[model samples]
Target: MAKKTNKYIKPFKNIFVFILLMFVVWMLFFDANSWLIHHELNSDIEDLEAEKEFYKNEIIKDKKAIKELSTEEGVEKLAREKYYMKQENEEIFIIEYQDSLPKNKEK
Candidate 1:
């Protein structure tokens, strides 16, 4: 009979090292607070932070608009432009050219 030796099997022969490796693997992948779970949570936090920044910018813009509309002229301009309101003696006429109309996709 010939004697056989394998270099790879030497370390795992120690019971303590094998158990330590198994514990590390379990903590990294199988535990409730695993590395994979933490990575997902971090990504979610990044998304929420970006969303918070966007809302903050929107609030600033809204505050500026509110300040502008605090005066009578700004309110009237907004009403006339957006809501198509006019003074009692004035008439509003809206003209649409061929290019200004929305094209139909059904054709």
Candidate 2:
């Protein structure tokens, strides 16, 4: 009876050790927090890439605008519209809208 019991105990102990090792591996490598962190990193990388693309497009637009403004006619048009400069004897009239009022209105 003792010999038979000893034989069965060894196999049961081996199986228990194997199960414990598997549980440790799963917790370290396949747990919920690990997966969540990996997913968040991927999403952050995607967002940064989108922002980089937006800035790249903005740079292209700015370069084109600069090229246009370097020309004589484009410079004249910008000055007239932005600075309100006109030809001699031309009058400048300013229009004010309620929605366009300054932030601080003292009255």
Candidate of highest TM-score: 1
- Predicted structure with the largest lDDT when compared to the true one: 1
TM-score on alpha carbons, each prediction = 0.89, 0.56
Candidate models: Cα lDDT each: 0.96, 0.85
Steric clashes per prediction: 0, 0
Model 2, position 19, has a per-residue lDDT of 95
Cα misplacement distance, residue 26 of candidate 2 (Å): 5.2
What does candidate 1's lDDT look like per residue over 1-107, in tens digits?
98776778888989999999999999999999999999999999999999999999999999999999999999999999999999999999988899999999996
Q: Judged by lDDT against the true structure, how good is candidate 2?
A: 0.85
lDDT of 2 at 98: 88
Off by over 4 Å in 1: none
The segments of candidate 2 whose C-alpha lies over 4 angstroms from its true place after superposition are 1-33, 94-107
Distance from true location, Cα of 11 in model 2, Å = 14
